[model samples]
Target: MEDSSEPFAILPADMFGQVTFIGGVSVEPLAAVGIIDEALTLVNDRLTEFAASPSFETDMQTVFGESVDVDLGRTIIDALSLGEGLPEITVVPAEKMNGIDGGFDSLTGGVYLADTSIAPNSVIGREPTQSPNLADVL
Candidate 1:
């Protein structure tokens, strides 16, 4: 992501193994997975080090603020950490689509939702539209 002017698709959950963590940059169906795959490649290499680091236990203690098992804490961090250079999804500052006029993709989901938030009215559909909808089908 790395913060771009380009529009990103707020894809369906099923697009990513039941949990869509990444969004497509330009509505290319594969963009989300592509990004995820790349990200996994990057982070996958670090998992061993992160897990083996002795100080990682200290890092865990710092995070938990209690005497929890260092192994468990390291495991959690190793599991959750997405690694460096994580792409920006531009989720923030968005006013989630919540109007009747705004359209939705029936094939993907029944209703349109911005979740906690979504792209603002102005930034949406400015140039290259990656909107996930089939107007004729709807």
Candidate 2:
């Protein structure tokens, strides 16, 4: 006696009561929202910290000539895991820019040399992840 093709819908209050009280879930809507806001702040703090951190904390010398050819390609990696220190290095050639024209200085304009271990910083305040993580109640 029911329309078989019709979709089912529940009211917000009912859903909230059932999911939060009946189900005994840990997250309530407002609490979840607060947690999410805090997490976003944390992520922003982390990003700022990383950006402010030194690009190359240590200075190292790279050997090059007047006409140094550099390779440009994607390097392969394996076994990505957390807690590993990021790998980034700026390879400053031990050469001086004197006679070159219309080209970036190979010495002063030094190239960034990094291993693939570095992780990109997260963008701030974009995706709304709290909607799903939060409980129906609030």
Full-model lDDT for every candidate: 0.39, 0.24
Residue 93 C-alpha lDDT in model 1: 17
Per-residue lDDT of candidate 1, residues 1-138 (tens digit): 543434444443222222132232223334434433443343445665767777776766787766879766566655545433222222221233343323345455433223222222222233345443211111
The estimated TM-scores of all candidates read 0.38, 0.24
lDDT (10s digit) by residue, model 2, range 1-138: 232223122112211111111121222434333343343344435544533446312211123333333221001111111212212112111122132211223455322211111112212233465321111110
How many backbone clashes are present in model 1? 4
**Cα error of candidate 2 at position 19, Å:** 16
After superposition, candidate 1 runs with Cα above 4 Å error:
1-25, 75-138
Q: State which candidate has the highest TM-score.
A: 1
Specify the poorest-scoring 10-residue window by lDDT in model 2.
72-81
